[model samples]
Target chain A: DQQVKQNSPSLSVQEGRISILNCDYTNSMFDYFLWYKKYPAEGPTFLISISSIKDKNEDGRFTVFLNKSAKHLSLHIVPSQPGDSAVYFCAARRTSGSRLTFGEGTQLTVNP
Target chain B: DTAVSQTPKYLVTQMGNDKSIKCEQNLGHDTMYWYKQDSKKFLKIMFSYNNKELIINETVPNRFSPKSPDKAHLNLHINSLELGDSAVYFCASSQVRDITDTQYFGPGTRLTVL
Candidate 1:
């Protein structure tokens, strides 16, 4: 069973626009959520993350918001750039677990 | 310097063959993990080793075995490979002080089985 799910398979947006990607999870025990961006033939790079204690976390142009009651999270990139084009994977870790469960990635294309 | 590196970036082999993929990390992290991405692009954790000790083993088949001789190296060996074994494997490392530690991943190794 997939605990994390990224419903959108692909997304397209114009440069300098805000890009929003959504993710949902079925397991409420997950306490930490992270987003990773991956390019073709390359491994995923850490982007942003949010702890269950907080509702939002921001790193520069990237922001992650978590809603515990809804069992959902989202990543938002403001003023998106072409370099932001990549597949984004949402991952979650249960409390006291060392392994991460990843969702089916969402391919984001930022058009210049 | 590469933080994490994997050898044989692409491998094509016939069914029933045995192959090994080596992974080494220079980040000095104590935890290493193996993840597989299938054709549908679903990434799943197979195994995790911390300080050369087996920590987490998922529901992966017995044909796949993971060995960590040291804290910085983890290798995956597959015996009697099947067609379903074809996928991209990624090696990652992290410092396990807490659950918030970020993991660094290596360039994935793509394996194709005929």
Candidate 2:
């Protein structure tokens, strides 16, 4: 069963525009949500994360918003740059677990 | 210096063969993990080790085993590999054995079984 889902397989946006990526999860036991960026032939790197206690978290040009009621979360990058283009994976960790369950990644392409 | 490194970036082997992938981290992290990225592009945790002790095994097949000789190294050995076992394996490490900590990952080892 896929506890986490990224409905959009790929998203394209022009440079300097705002890019939004969405993720949904069915597991309410998750204590935190995380986003990772991965390039071709490279391992994924941590981008940002939001705790279940908080509704939003921001770092630099990236912001993550979580809606507990909707069981959904989103990552927004303002003034998107080509360098920010990569496959984004949304992951969740249960309150009592140390492993991360990941969703099928979404490929975000920022066209220059 | 590489925070986490995996050897044999790409491996091609026949079914029934056995192979091993070595991973080492220089970040001084106490927790280490192995993740497999399948064809569907979902990263799944295979095993987790902390302080040279096996902490978590995600019901991976018995054919796949993880060995941590020391705090900074974790190796995965697969016996009688099957075609379905082909996937990209990634090694990661964190300061503490918690999901809240940031995990640094290696480039990954792409294994292909025929």
Candidate 3:
């Protein structure tokens, strides 16, 4: 079963615009959520993460919002740059779990 | 420096052949994991090892075995490989002691079985 789901397969946005990617999880046991950006032929790189205790976390232009009640999380990239074009994956870690469950990933293209 | 690294970025072999993928992390992390990205772009965890001890096994087939010679290394060996096993494999490492346990990934290895 897919514990985490990213319904949007792809998203396109103009550079300097806001880009939002959403993810939902079926398991309430997941306490930590993270976002990873992956480029072609490269492994995914960590972006931002939020703990269940917190509702929002921000770093630079990337922000992550977690709504525990809704079992949903989202990544917002403000002023999206062309360099931000890549596949973005949402991942979750169960309480005290060693492995991460990843979503199918959403491809984001930021056009200049 | 590369925190995580994998050897043989691409592998192509016959269905019946046996092959191995090696992973190493220089970050001195105690936990390492193997993840498979299939054609549908699903990244699923296969195995995880912490300090050379198996922590998670996601019900993978018996043909796939993970070996942790040391905390810094985790290798995957597949015997009698099948065409269905073709996919990109990624290695990741994290420090279990860290509360978040943020993992860093290596450049993936793509395997093609004919």
Candidate 4:
């Protein structure tokens, strides 16, 4: 059973526009959520994360919003750049757990 | 200076063969983990070790074994590989003392079983 799900397989957006990636989780026990960006032939790198207690967290041009009641979270990249094109994965960690459960990933293409 | 590194980026072998993948991290993290990404792009955790002790072992097959000689090195060995074993395996590390510690992943090793 997949606890985390990224329904969108791919997304396309124009450069300098906003890019939004969505993720959902079935386990309410998950208290921390994170986003990772991965390029071809490269490992995923940490992007942003939010705790279930908070609704949103922002760093630079990236922002993550979490809704505990809806069991959904989203990553927003404002003024997306070409370098932002990559596979984005949403992961979650259960309460007091160290291991992360990842989603199927969403490939985002930022067209210049 | 790569934080996490895995040897044999690509491996191809027969179904009945035995193979091993090595992983090391220089970031001085106390925890290590192994993850597998299947053809459908679903990433799943197989095992995790903290300070040379096994902490988490998912519902993976007995054919897959993980060893941690030290806090910085974790290796995976697969015996009697099956066709379903073909996938990209990633090794990651994190400092377990912090609750918000983020894991650093390696480039990944792609194993192909013929």
DockQ of each: 0.73, 0.60, 0.71, 0.69
Query: Mind giving the per-residue lDDT tens digits that candidate 3 earns over B7-86?
Result: 98999999999999999999999889999999999999999998999999998999999999999999999999999999
Model 4, C-alpha of A17: deviation from truth (Å): 0.4
Candidate 2's residue-wise lDDT over B43-91, tens digit each? 9999999899998899889999999999999999999999999999999
Q: TM-score of each candidate?
A: 0.98, 0.96, 0.98, 0.98
Residue ranges of candidate 2 with Cα displaced over 4 Å: A95-97, B97-99
Docking class of 3: medium
Instruction: Candidate 3: give the clashing pairs.
Output: none
User: What interface RMSD, in Å and to 1 decimal, does model 4 have?
Assistant: 1.5
Candidate achieving higher lDDT, 2 or 4: 4
Greater DockQ among 1 and 3 belongs to: 1
Candidate 2: CAPRI quality band: medium
DockQ computed for model 1 against the true two-chain complex using alpha carbons: 0.73
lDDT of 2 by residue, A12-108 (tens): 9999999999999999998799999999999999999998999999999999999999999999999899998999999998743378889999999
How many residue pairs clash in all the candidates, one count each?
0, 0, 0, 0
lDDT of 4 by residue, A34-107 (tens): 99999998889999988888999999999999989899999999999999999999999974337899999999
**Just chain B of model 2: what TM-score?**
0.96
Comparing only chain B with the true structure, the TM-scores of all models are 0.98, 0.96, 0.98, 0.98
Number of the top-ranking candidate, with DockQ as the measure: 1
Candidate with more favorable, higher TM-score: 1 or 2: 1
